[model samples]
Target: MLRTPAAVRDAGRHTAHNYHPLPVVISSAEGAWVTDVDGRRYLDCLAGYSALNFGHRHPTLIATAHAQLDRLTLTSRAFVHDQFADFCRELAALCGKELVLPMNTGAEAVETGIKVARKWGYQVKGVPAGQATIVVADGNFHGRTTTIVSFSTDADARADFGPYTPGFRVVPYGDLAALAEAVDEHTVAVLLEPVQGEQGVVVPPEGYLPGVRQLCDERNVLFIADEIQSGLGRTGATFACEQDGVVPDVYLLGKALGGGIVPVSAVAADAAVLGVLKPGQHGSTFGGNPLACAVATEVVRLLASGEFQRRSTELGERLHSGLRALIGKGLVAVRGRGLWAGLDIDPALMSGREACERLMERGVLAKDTHGSTIRLAPPLVVTPEEIDHAVAQLAAVLAG
Candidate 1:
């Protein structure tokens, strides 16, 4: 007789069903693999939605975190800690911006970006107070906060989360004309992900980012690129905007910034744009604590080395080619950049949830976003052979 796993059953016994997770309960992880409580091993392809981009327990990140724990952890925003300046300066330089405002989570970073843009519009851009509007892509997945979800096109993330926040205009993601038509004198900023992670790792069409940049520049609107899931080496570049030769006025960053040890998020921009915020107007108690700063500073230095970015670009080609070959046999299409990819399974064969379950049974862990789409974003530390193995396991799952 087969018994249901205790970890799977107990996981939902007292918790909310916000996430329909796979039945595997991870007990330990290293590089790109995790071990279940029962001692079974599985290759992790989701990489915590890119939060573990450097892989689990990276040596530098862990060491820094440990040292900080021994020294200091939190001091609040009242009195600055020793590790704060270095983190802010280094991360700002990483984004090539002059200033940075650290926060705690990806959603806080998005909300901070929205607040800064509106304030900048009223104070710097000469827009009328309380009339500023920000444009967002139709299929964006910035975060689940009430204000952030107000503009989301995904019904599941937005439904029942209202009366939603106002002043956001939604436009088709890849349509420049629609975006341009949506913006006007009252527009303050345009927030978007260069690669929409939750919307199945959807990469916009070529020239779409450049067009957005041009539109924002022509209309004097700040361009805020939400790089929470697409930045910090996941997209083969320090920032995904570099892929299109576009530099946004503000960069919303998080996910891997904390090295998967703590939650660290930030908004970066030149002084003129972010200077609109007066002291006490916006701050987080734990935004740049000693521990978060220590860990995140090392993360910035790691990205500065560009090794992870190189690995993502080199390994991504191999991964994508293999996935494309399975199109007619099972997959319908694949789209993404760098180490990120969205695989569309033939719904006739199996839904994404079923495919993921079958893959988990074969020792490969992945995630489903939409009905038939699966997102693959293995950590940059993953090896070429491991990538091949994951692809093979996926193919076998489809075959069955």
Candidate 2:
């Protein structure tokens, strides 16, 4: 008879019930695969929600982490660390921005962007104090902090996390007219995800980003693009906004920035918009620490080479083509671009959670977002054959 694994039982006993994880206990991971405690291997289709874009323990990132650990790790924001200047400078160049504010997580970066936008509104845009407003979309997922979740459309993330933060407006995800109607003179910023990851990899309309940029420019509002999950090389471009020829006033970046080694997020913007932040107004203890900087600087250098972006573009086509063919079989629809995809399973067959569980049993690890939608985002290092393998497994799971 089969027995439950001790690792799984222990994990459930010890940890908080915040995450309903799969029954497998991952002991280690490399490239696009993770091994359970019993030595079973599974293709990692989630890629840590696009965090491990370079794959787990990438050599360059690990080497940088090791070297930096020996020399120094933390200096907080109180004193300048050796890695501070290079990370800030390179990340700024990557965003085509004049300045960078480092933070530890995606939530912190989102909060930082909000604070900066409000300050910029009051100082530069000549808006009334405490009256600044920001416009957001319906299906956005910025982060889980109290302030960030206050604007979340997801009931689970937002409910009971209030009295919610005010001064933000929610409009439809891909409607330009609704957004235009929502924006007014008091609007300080228009915050959006170029491709909504948690909302089932939902892609906005083709011209939506450019339209937002035009509207923000016309209204003197900062266009803040939350690129934490959709940025880096996951979307086949350095930033998803590049696909639409739109340049946001502020770029909130995280995920792959730390090369899956450390938690590092940053808000990048021109001096005019970001200059509103004075010292002690915002900070993080481990935001741009030596280890994070060293790892992230290499991530920036890797992105600068353009190889990973090209891989995502070419390999993503192979992935999407395979998935699109399966739509009528068990998948109702497929959304997303580059290496990212959301497969909406036929409700008659299974829920997204059930599909993910089946895939887990068959050695593939994808995650369900909501209802019948499952998201597939393998590491950028995934090969064409591996992509084929993952898709084949999904086909078999559906067939059963």
Candidate 3:
């Protein structure tokens, strides 16, 4: 018989101590629920940090993956595959961009965006060679890449990752004045998450995204929206920027793009911006492979139907409303859009880690960030009852 404690301990015995996972030993998952190795069940509220926006092994996505797996999988960028053009065309259409450059991870997409922006800076924007600067926001979580971490304000992510890459500037998020001041002659792009997911699903002030778009246009800089966590129906819209009534010059997308099955990411931009890349400039072998494209193509189809987006909009109201009702009871604050939310548990009562552990014991899985902030991003397939149950579990944890 598989036991939870021994399984959990053995699971971490050989791996790097990078993640501090919960005590639950999940063996299989379907939709919004998972079964532990010991046959215990729990609700998955984190949703793979939005990677499972469509839910675990969604039928269509799984079918597509299986079909593609039986066929071709990879051909590299050297030769075009059957699934390449359709995925790019559909995703570009979804993003309202002229071209899409595929990669295998969100970090790679970020890196690709940086490279493209710099190349566009020199080739089109006429910035001095090797002096192009991309301004980013503080409290941002782009990725763990050294270059992306260079402008990160999080000490844990930024520390010891240097001598950090230069040519990037960090400004306080949601502060248009600071951002405007930071943009100057050599500024190539302003990269930001329309909604900061890792910093506890933090949403900026209203009009902030539009103001950035206007500033980027006025400054001849690219507005790169890193929507890895906020796009593809996670934020009650196709993209979170849409909530603020703005469209960025470039879209850095990943996470949910692969339907939680494979790692897939892409950077979408108009020809004038992305055309700066020549052959042999930047490429990924697994990017746009048949399996990734097949799954992502289904993902695009799913989002195109607008069902998940609508679910996020309608259900998010319920989730947020329930969370707000607990403000004085235990939660200090709640912030997010759609089904994505970050709850700040009253630190005087208990830390976020403790809250998550307690919630875990109650068969609800959640993750905590910073000190007292808990992020809840249940799958879009999660029903109203599941949301209420998760919220009730949270209330119970707080009451105790």
Candidate 4:
């Protein structure tokens, strides 16, 4: 019989120690719950770090994946598959962009955006050849890709990953003055996350996103919004930037784009920016594969229906209210929008890791970032009762 300890031990025996996962050995999952190897169940509050925004094994996405699997899966960009056009067209429409460049991961999408921005900078914005620069914000977590990390302020993700990629500038997040100072004639793009998900669901001050948008427009620089962890109905909108009433030049999207069934990512931009790339400029093998497109197409359709976004908005209020009540009890602060949140636990009480362990003991699963900050991003499909239960569990943990 499989047990948590033996399963976890054997699983980690050979794997690299890059991740320090919880000891719970999950064997199966459905919707907002997962069953461990020891027959224990836990509420998945983290939701695959927003990758499972639609919940685990959503019926529509699963059916699409299964159907595509039986019919067809892969075809390199050398030839087009039937599923490609619809996926690209719909996603582009959703993003309000003229074209979509499909990729398989968020990092790949970010890299593609960087390349496109630079190409547009040279060919369109007239930035001299090797001098094009992109400005990023501090406390950003676009991805761990070498170039992405080159401008990252996180030590753990950035340290020793050098000689780092250059031509990137970093500025403090939410400070328009610093960003303006960073931007120059050679600036190709200003890349940012509408909400800093890894930095504890940190929403910028009001007007920050719009300010960035205006800055990019006036300076003739592309605005790339990395929505990998915060888009696709997780933030009570198709995109978190929508809440701020801002639209970036390029949208880097992934995570829920696959509906938690597969890896699918994309960059959506208007023709003038994305069209800078010719045929041979960028391509991915499994990107836009029939299977990915089929599943992601359904994902796009689901988002189009607006059901998940509504759920996130309505349920997010309840979630934030509950967490806010716990501020004096144990939480120091709560910050986020929609169903996504970052809770800063009182360090005097316990570290975020300890709080998470305690929450796990009570049948809730969550993830902690930084030191005392725990982020909550439950699946959008989660019910009101589940939200109350998770909040009550957190309250009980904090009370103790």
lDDT of 1: 0.93
lDDT of 4 by residue, 60-116 (tens): 888888888999888888898999999999999888889999999999999999999
- Across 1-400, the per-residue lDDT of candidate 3 in tens digits comes to 6598898899899999979999888889999999998999999999999999999889999999999999999899899999999999999999999999999999999999999999999999999899999999999999999988888899998898799999999999999999999999999999999999999999999889999999998999999999999999999999999999999999999999989999999999999999999999889888889999999999999999999999999999999999999999999999999999999999999989999999999999999999999999999999999999999999999999
Residue ranges of candidate 4 with Cα displaced over 4 Å: none
Q: Given candidate 1, what's the lDDT at residue 384?
A: 93
What's model 4's TM-score? 0.99
Structural RMSD, model 3: 0.8
lDDT values for all models:
0.93, 0.93, 0.95, 0.92
TM-score for every candidate vs. truth? 0.98, 0.98, 0.99, 0.99
Off by over 4 Å in 3: none
Number of clashes in model 1? 0
Give the least accurate 10-residue stretch of model 3, judged by summed lDDT.
1-10
Question: What does candidate 1 score on TM?
Answer: 0.98
Q: Residue-wise lDDT of candidate 2 within 1-400, one digit each (tens)?
A: 2233776788889789989888888888988889877788999999999999999889989999999989999988899988999999999999999999999899999999999999999999899999999999998999998888888999999988789889999999989999999999899999999999999999998888999999988888899999999999899999999999999999999989989888999999999988988888888888888899999999999999999999999999999999999989999999988999999999899999999999999999999988889999999999999999999999999998
